[model samples]
Target chain A: MKEIRVFSPATVANVNCGFDVLGFALDGLGDEMVIRKVPEKGIKITKITGAELPYKAKENVVGVAGLAMVEALNLDFGFEIEIHKNIRLGSGVGSSAASAAGIVYGINQFLETPLSNLELTAFGMKGEAVASGNEHADNVAPCLYGGFTLITGYEPLRIVSLPVPEELYVTIIHPHITIKTKEAREILPEQVSLKNAIKQTGNLAGLIAGLYEADYGLIASSTQDVLVEPYRKNLIPDFDFYKQTALKNGGLAFGISGSGPSMFTLSKGLQNAGAVEFALKKALKEKNMKSESYVSPVSKHGNRILEQK
Target chain B: MKEIRVFSPATVANVNCGFDVLGFALDGLGDEMVIRKVPEKGIKITKITGAELPYKAKENVVGVAGLAMVEALNLDFGFEIEIHKNIRLGSGVGSSAASAAGIVYGINQFLETPLSNLELTAFGMKGEAVASGNEHADNVAPCLYGGFTLITGYEPLRIVSLPVPEELYVTIIHPHITIKTKEAREILPEQVSLKNAIKQTGNLAGLIAGLYEADYGLIASSTQDVLVEPYRKNLIPDFDFYKQTALKNGGLAFGISGSGPSMFTLSKGLQNAGAVEFALKKALKEKNMKSESYVSPVSKHGNRILEQK
Candidate 1:
């Protein structure tokens, strides 16, 4: 295909218990992009809408990630990308990851021999790095591989796709505020007590096991953050109140979505998720904060073609 | 059923990446105990045969655990326990756990309304605390619940049972050395870098996911311990050589079982496990270290009735 339009879904990273390791993609909540093959040997961002972002090829995450994929393949042909964003920038719901993952996914489809999702994820991480100042896969991997993804190792970049429970739903609220990923990271302690570290791992293991078993109670109990949440929660207003609202409304788990400003709650069913969304939105409104809310089943597939030629 | 005899299997705790949280029970290698109900209201150690242990009920792990169970039940009658030792003391292969878990299992069999494995696990932990100077269920949970267990939360004490792959086998070699659990714990750093903590949880989450899916490759890759192994490996002589030998043979994953003196390796099949066992035994022999080794599939049952009257 010479041209392809794709939808790159938003993702929830850190996932409460799995800081820097786990993430899950969302359904029908993301950004759209159209890419066209060009004769030139470099990527260019032809247009962007809905959010103001860097337009330069070197500064834009979409361009940086696309270029990484092209350079790795040593491709002679370039691509022009037009992005239409629905996800808010710096909302901690993986706005940059949507663009970064979507672009590479589109480019890979145009390849004579398409790269694996794992490979696409690596290139997409370059774009994530441009935004976060770190080469982290917690967001990009799930956006590429879909469902839930676990980055088991970083030195060699091993990503594992996890089983998604059938009834799982997510309610995310993005307050009209931005918490820079770098600043959010700076608030964390460089060192953590061994006791807390063990607790975190236990919860992570339990969460992974619960996903496979489809045990909602296990998932709810296990979705706790001990390593990073305490420091970063302050970045989001009324974090505890919102979490209580979500939990009181049948949310299975609640935490800062990625680095904050946006928070997510997981629920067992669509109705429960909707209730959580209503409660969180109400809580946000009471706090006099402008916010956007989304209730979606965990996305089964990640980046996918919307139209192709 | 006023009297019951039970066989409580040995267990391997801290299974690599899951320190103080994960463990799996072993088959055929454990201790046998006989408990008799009397008109009295206290637990007593009637006879000791395997290894020398405290005869007083308060000092003995078997009595202490049984007393914990009886107190919770508010039993009007007490029991007498006879011990026949199989697992070695201070072997770090959960020798004390076998005794503690066995007595509780035997006593529960006599209860008109027996406690759940979860309740028995709590009682078993009391005995464990007497042995290790801490109430940890990594070993006891697996011993009571059978199969693999994850202690997800300690505050409210949540135990999760994980699936055991049909072909999974464990090879444990106990070198004739002793490392007290307290002294081994003291060697560990009170704090760890957040970077290392994240890596450990990544591996742990992967391991749990791998177990549920029975993906041996994922299990092999994820069975890594970063938090405690580095500091504790020195206590075990030739830890590196034995690990290399096991991995070089057919072991899927290898690590110090609990604290030290004993090391365990998991392999995919019985033949592969035997090969790892042979290689590890030979390596120990070459190093002039006397050791005992056992190869068995991950136990599907914990304590079980041997004889009853």
Candidate 2:
């Protein structure tokens, strides 16, 4: 194939109780990349659009990911990548992951030497490392795998795709603000009380069970965060107002998505999701905060080839 | 019904990564309680067997559970309970939960009132409180509902029954040593590093996914405990030897049963369970420690009515 275009979805990591371990992909809000094989045995970034991100191949997530994949697979061919970043950077919505995963996914398609999802994830992690100075896969895995994902172990890199209930809808409100992942992570406590740890563990277990059994009530009740949300909520404007407004208006569960500036709520159906979105947007409007909202189902396909020529 | 006999199975609490949040019931090890109605309007404990325990109604777990049930239901009938304790106390195998849950289960059967499982769990928590000075439902809930149970929340007392794969077998080795639950709890660190806490959360989410999907490899890999087992394993003699032996002899996962002297290992099949049991017992014998071992499938029924007359 001469060229391949792929779309990689955005993801909301943590999912309330599962900080740094659990995440789910969204049908909307993603990044697209186009890759074309070149004669020279080198990687290049041809163009960038939609968001202000680094353009230099070595500094860009897509270029870094492409380099990692080429080196890991020992490819002799060159490739040029075009980035269309739809997911916002510093929005806590896995924007970097979308670009990172999309480029690798696009290259794998163009070369027809598809790497395993796990292997692709490792390359994506390298991209994430370039963006955040840490190789974290919580966002990348879900962005690549689709649906809900659990990063069970990081040392050997174990990722498990969890079941997602069919009726689940996600409503995300991204205020026009920025909270870098590094800053959000630095504010977290070095240690947490055993009491909170136990509570967090229970919530994570309950959430997983809820997903497996398709129990919406359990999922709502279990999507509580006693560990990360308390510390990171400060970075988001009117975080409590958005969360409470969403829940009071029929949202099943609500929390700061990933690090912050972006918040999400889960609902059972489209009607409830619409209500939650309306309420959240109204609350942000009343506060005079410029924000964008997207209501989408949990995406089942994380990254996919849009076209090939 | 004039009288009812019920069996409440023993449970292993804090199943590795899920300290104070996860537990599973055993098939054969349990406490049997026979409850009979009388003319008086108060609860009483008439007899005790197999273990030395208090006979006073308020001082014993069975009586406390009976009292809780009676008060909650406003039942105006007297009851006499006979305890046949098969699960050893202070063996870290939820001995107190078995007794507390067995009596309430028998009482519920004789009355035919059929309290909801959550209500029964609440009453069972009262029983556990009488034994441990705190109302904990980790063990009691699993003993009441069977299979794997997750105590998602404590305020409203939420309990979720998780799926158990069919090929799983459990082997428990209970040594003749005592480690009080209170002391075992006291030795735990007041706080854990945020790093370890996040790791534990991931393992729990993974394990729940493993159970729901019936993935043995995921279960084995996710069964590791980084929070509690390292501290409590010291109370068990030859803990490292027994754990290593069980894993080497075909066990999929191994950990402390509850708080102390007893240890448990999970295997994929009967043959594996037999091998694990044999290896574990041989190791215990070599240490000059007398221990009892039971190999059984995961109990599907938490508590059951043996007979009604």
Candidate 3:
């Protein structure tokens, strides 16, 4: 029997400019899952996770995703699944997406990779119904495919995986704090002013043009958010400092990560990602808070196996 | 001396699924302005629109737009300006936007086209301020340009004038009944559910992708509006038939145009456009509702002067 262990990186949705409409994966932060086909009747989850998760097997973040594959493939042999979580859960770092990615990735392996990335993402998004009670693909698509991806219409994914610009750098700061994604969602205003939506449309358009045209300045400028950020920024520690400091150090734009206590910034020509990492650290410290910061390129591939036995 | 006269089309801001974000210009409706410049030293508002106007030269709808132009370029010129009427005067089809567009267009010509289209539109958006007491561009850009445009951002619009896809067609129906744009604006609920916003985000994302990829099927499906349409559709007369009939034909998408009394459908093929328009006219006739229907392709240029002398 072959046992394979894999990891899928965390993700950030909205990306400031593309609020609720765009997302991408990170290379490092995420979760791990291991699975092995066993000589059993039907596939089932064997363990919960490294951290306590809700809803036993059915509520299992990645478990539901694996179930989808089993149902779709009409599998007979059961498989044992185990998960290891690394990303900060509920920090808007796509913690749930990692587990879901693991299930989809491992099951694809078990199924001999029958489904395409689009199909796999569709099944994985069903797992979102368990995690967030919403079948949102912003985080899941990127974690599955990597890079800056636009999840337009998810039923076949219909993802547009945009090339990460050469001059781009990203900085992420995860504060050692808990801000429930649901809680973050609760604070959002029901109706945004028409003006903000218009602005967002333009910014998102510019952001897309920037990516295609390789106009860093336009992308940087377009990354400003007006709708969700103004309401949500009040929850993040050192929100203004993290952005201003990072920009001063070479970052082009900054905004909250998903529904965040974690925040991120984009940069142009800043090679030493650590400078941004340190800058955010300093800002958090000034707020009497301690947060871990990450500086890495946008993940180009979403989930992958690290080892097999 | 020479006289220059032109018409600007009314635009729908916050395109259905893109609430507060996307807008498009429509043909067959808007405001008209006439300008004649003489080798003189001053500017004069010789005649204001006689139609159901706001009733003053300085405070008139088109007057504010003219003010934005003179102030922007710091140009002093002797000219006689006249505001005329057409377009559903109070419909959300950017009734006031035409005024803004006219003022800017008139000034540009009167000033010998010193300002580019970019500068002219910015000057035009000030007319929105006259109407809503706020400056906005979704209406002005198309009113000034004469085609489909993407208003990417603001202050100075991050605008993109895009090519309308050859397959795309629009069917518009204007009922003889009146619904003031302001009254329609007041009908919007003060708050919207977060769930709805999330749905809209998905729809908006899908719509943008559909337009970009030229996937008429997706565009049709993604044109849904969970937040605004349900509430506002109630205001239009026989909206259901208009919507269903359009879709039953070859229409890819259908929704209320701007505020009320008008509805539009996007079609992937011209056959669908004609069919939808035919169906709408037929339905209106059945209801004994006097109405006008048009099957026009998406305007490629928003506010270009067809002729000037």
Considering every candidate listed, which one attains the maximal lDDT? 1
| Model 1 chain A poorest ten-residue lDDT run | A177-186
Error of 1 at B181 (Å): 1.7
Worst 10 residues of 3 chain B by lDDT: B193-202
- Regarding DockQ, does 2 or 3 come out ahead? 2
Instruction: Tell me the tens digit of each residue's lDDT in model 2 across B1-309.
Output: 798888889899888888888899999878888889988876888889999999888888888888988877888787988889988777888989998888777777757558878888889889999878898988998998999999888777888998889998999998888788777888899899999888888888888999988899999999988888888888776788888999999998999887767888999998999999998889999999998999989998899988889
Q: Name the regions of candidate 2 deviating beyond 4 angstroms.
A: A111-113
- TM-score rank order: 2, 1, 3
Which candidate ranks first by TM-score, i.e. highest? Answer: 2
Worst lDDT run of 10 residues, candidate 3 chain A, spans A193-202
RMSD vs true structure, all candidates: 1.9, 1.7, 4.4
> Taking the tens digit of each residue's C-alpha lDDT, what string does model 1 give over B101-151?
999888888877888998898999999988888888989989988999999
Candidate 1 CA-lDDT value: 0.91
Candidate 2 local lDDT, A147-177, one digit each (tens): 9989988778999988889999999999998
Count clashing pairs, candidate 1: 0
**Model 1 Cα lDDT, one tens digit per residue, A142-248:** 99999999999877889999999999999999899878877887899999999999989999999998999999999999998999989999888788999999999
